[model samples]
Target: MASEDLKEDQEVSFCLNLFTLRCGHSFCRVCINQVLNTKEGSGVYSCPECRAEFKEWPSLQRNVTLCNAMENFISNNPQQEEITGISCTYCVHSPIPAIISCLLCESSLHNNHLRVHSEEAKHVLTDPSSSIENRKCSIHKELLMYYCTEDAACLCMSCTLAEEHWGHQVEILDEAIERKKEKLSDVLRKLYMQRQKTEERVQRLEECRGRAHQKANREAERLNALFTDIRNQLDDLEKRMHCEISRQEEQESLSISDLIQKLELKKDELSRNIRSIEDLCNMPDPLTILQEPDMGDLCDPEEGEGEEVTGYVDDPEQEEADEDSKGDTGGDYGFQQILHTLSNIISDVNVVFYGQRPADILLDVNTAANNILISDDLKTATRTDKKQNRPETAESFQCFQVMSKERFTSGRHYWDVEIAESGICWVGVCYPSIDRRGWQSYIGSTNKSWSLFIGRGYRNQCSVSHNKSELMLPYQIFSAGVRIYVDYEAGQLSFYELCDPIRHLYTFTTTFTEPLHAAFCVWNKYVKV
Candidate 1:
């Protein structure tokens, strides 16, 4: 009866793969499968645990709740009792569960035994280690109280007075421990501060990375916007070119058609005359031939008739001849115009998007002509009727011209000239070694100079490579400034008429053999830069 009660209290093992039947009985899946197989021939099934009757077979469902409970119970009751019993090694009356073990005696003790051993032996006790024996000096058999620095050993007070360790530098153990602890604390503090500095550096770098990412995104957006404009301009230009070509084709086709119609009419008239002449020639009598009404009016064409046919015959060739006109003529004319327009647009875009631009260009009085009067700040120059008293130098221009103190040998540069109080001022770039004393030394008059002139409300550009090109300014106001861009390496000098939307005046292409100086000609009053 006692074994039965114990067995009833013990936990019964249950397979995790359990299934529930309609009769409320739980069993492993294997047992349920065997029962279903055994009752298959009879066409009937029942729960093995309950022995309940069922006519039709019903599908079983897994007992998920019971399976989860079993898993948790098994995990909570994991088997871990390796040493089932611990008995006192010192007690002889009966084996007792140990509470503490003594390494000096190499024995386990119960609470009662441990109390008696501690009262009689008075041995130092710990949970497991024999630290008491280790603390006692091997030779002195006493607790260590001082440390000998000279011998690098721990010693009792008696050992310090021994002959072998006499006169050694000694320190109390407690004092040494305190000093070491303070040093260790200082080291830990320094390490903590270093860690903080490293953390701060990392945070700073992360912030810098974030800002850099933002700036890169902004720059990418700007580039995208710029490319969008470029694409639109290209599309518009393409459409215009196509339209112009189509217009020319239509006009040529119409003219050719009209000439073909006229020629067909003339050919029909000639064929009729030939037929009438053939009929007269078919006459048997010579008198009939002579009497056939005025054959001159029939066979012979009227005067000036050849000229009309010749004109009609030339119309087809006229279209081809028109296509082969002078430089940049016909279809090529539109192409050249578009190329120049796109180049101008791209140049303006570069000026707006690119690097450092020309700023305040201070004019050099020493390089100015004698007839030129420079302002106090050396940014304004005025032409005088009489020459002013000034020191003569080879750098000074003898003509009505003044140059900037800044000289450019390479790289691109841009500067604006505010043409005020003068309708006819010349703004351009020229070689520093250009003839400055002769009548032909005027800007745009020599090979070493290129200039843009605005006078009488007219804008004109002059270069040594091509003849003067007359351009219409967006605005008629001459007081508005003009921007000059010089690309030294590319050997290009471009002039722009500055207005709300800047317009390109002209561009000069030439190889620069020497450094160029920014030259200004104040023909009448004054010009500010």
Candidate 2:
């Protein structure tokens, strides 16, 4: 009866393959199939435990819940115990689980047994494991106590005294483990700090990118607003010109209309005067003609006004030419106005800012390279054939280079340098920390400096270089020399050729971390700033 009850309980338990009947009862597929096969010919069958009736033809649906639960249960339970692992030897009678093992006794103990276990320095307690044989030296059959530093392995006392490890450095196994743990902890701390620093650098880079995007957006917005205003102003200027021409046209038309009205009245008066004269000449009665008013009345006192009207009507071409003459004058006037306003607008857009630009930039003698001669006023650097007797200093340059006395750390600054008309030279900016020897010290060859190199030939090919990368600038004529401008905080360096209208030569951009000084490299010529 007990076995039958247990089997019934197994029908609804979690298993690998399970299926549910129409009545919501679950059972393993194997057991359900085995029981249904017994009633194969019967068309219907009854559930084993619930006794629920079901058609033999009913489709079986796999129970997914039971499959998943079965997977988890099997993975975590019924694990085969390791035969070599230590168990509760002291708990042999009770057979309780072992929690700790004693190396001195080679036995595992439970909590109650450990309360009465021997308390000795040699009794090393640890997690219950089958390490009795592993803990001892296979050759000596003795428990390994000391650690051999030379061989990086555990050693038994007998092995430590033997010929193999005779004079090698050794420490207690417990002490060695502790020391290793301490070093590991220290290394872990350093790794954590390194990770923190990396995170901070990443965040800083992201912020820089955000700020750059904002700056670009602001510049675009400003330009857009400015252009829109310019367009509106241009539109207003055009409207004002049209209005002026319209006013001129209106005034000329009104004047011509008034003259035409006067001409019509004068024509009627001239016609009446002629008709009266013809009547007086046709009359035969001299007395009747004499009876008319005095000669002043017959002649008409307003005849002079009519003569003026007749003069304007006789010169039709002249009248037409006179009309709207002021309209042409107004057009000329608007043209001058348009030209003047455009010139002013252009000046405002490209307004030259000469603020804080040093007029006289002096050279530093200490940083001058070999054979470089500085003028007494320190404004000029000349490359001489004869080397001057100067003491070698840390700040001195090894090549044909020189630096300015003035160092720029912040704000915008620009200085003009007059280069030799025909010679190879370099004009750029460099940090004070530039290398003092080898090719790296040459201007434009290292990351610490930026330079523009002008060639010796007629074309005077110019190239800008930084960190060993060079970009050749399109050849252009230079009349005066070159101008160097630097915005330290903005990390912008620009070189402009002092030609007509001051053409921009090149520009370099970077994040400057140190103060910068103007750098110059010249040979076979002199440069003045």
Candidate 3:
């Protein structure tokens, strides 16, 4: 064991010859013998403890267990004890204990020979102290018994009575030490309390920072998914536009190729006519020309063919009409559609991302009402007309309601609930201890819950309810979803319209004594969080 752990046991039993009496008290043999020697002639004796009477002198027995334990402890811890112990400075043969220390000589001696030292007061002896120089004043070389508070210095009797500090405030050295020690203790306690507060604040800041980073990561993931979908849609639009433009290009090229073929045919016919005229003029070939039986048919092409071919002319308006008839959407139509799509996407994003994060929630199937159906992913919940085959349990809701599986006990969190059909559902939070089988157990039916009832009994109306009390909103909610926010330690639960710019609907303020779970009640359709 370490030195400190063995100090108390060593102090109680340090001698080798230990003995125990009938009363079970153990002490050194030397001490026991001394006590017994004084009571030798007495007819009766008593134990130091328990005071048990003994008719005769009790025999002492060596305590083997205590003797061995002491020996083992001392052997292990001898270095520490010897370092702190005082020894005689004059004993050169063997180590010996010192009885007194002379301040003038600054040495401890056994004093076995008194004639060796002076008898003057300056050489006076006191308890054997290893640091005896501190007892004397530096200038007067006299024992310091007072303190000069004006100079905050230790002083001897002569310094306080005759030195330049004669008029300064002074007090006994022992009293000054005691007063300073008390002040130091008070300062130490305040410092400890301040340290604890700083540590606690540091822990709180660390937690807040961790949660912020987590929220940022989740938001980044959601944005990536959204952008990925938008990119896919744009790619499809580009492909369709390319196909339509290629079709229009092929149709116009075919019309131009047909016109070129007609011109080539007309050129060949004209060349043949020129050759026939030249032969008639050069060969004096009037007879030969007249003899050509089919010359008339060759000289004149089909009567209306030339007129029909030459009448063809490009018209921008006609081409546009043809394009419309053929259902070509290559120009402006796709561009406008893309602009509309982007506008809608931007508007929806403005509503969803309102400088706040969405909490993840899942419906607890075990807590659903009899007719409620949970989607395979445990995100969507709908109330069915037919009852389900579910066993009765304490956690199950009796009405068309279900609670989320996750429980929130501290910090701030918010989640969005998308309503398939407005004015047909209720969304809110409730204590986990809320009732299970009665009307009182239904969400917002008791004081343990707070809920926003949507589109229940009126058109363009919603209400916040608690403890059977309700406050109906005068304004309409065109929002497709609702945002539920809760600050647990702050005791604030608020609801907002999940529309563009996010409007506040209501808030519930009260001390929440239990962890809360997201609760929902739906009469038709479904809600997804």
CA-lDDT, candidates in order: 0.70, 0.74, 0.75
Count backbone clashes in candidate 2: 0
Identify the candidate with maximal lDDT: 3
Candidate 3 TM-score over all chains jointly: 0.38
Question: Candidate 3: minimum summed lDDT over ten consecutive residues — where?
Answer: 304-313
**Comparing 2 and 3 by lDDT, which wins?**
3
Question: What TM-score goes with each of the models?
Answer: 0.47, 0.34, 0.38
Runs in model 1 lying further than 4 Å from the true structure: 1-236, 239-243, 284-286, 293-333, 346-362, 370-389, 398-400, 409-411, 415-425, 437-442, 453-482, 497-503, 522-529
What TM-score does candidate 2 reach? 0.34
TM-score sort, best first: 1, 3, 2
> lDDT value for candidate 1?
0.70
Backbone clashes, each candidate: 0, 0, 2
Rank list by lDDT = 3, 2, 1
Q: Write the per-residue lDDT of candidate 2 for residues 142-255, one digit (tens) a residue.
A: 777999999999998788888888889999998999999999989988985786566456546645764664566555665565556567778999899889878866776676
Instruction: Tell me the lDDT of model 3 at 115.
Output: 53
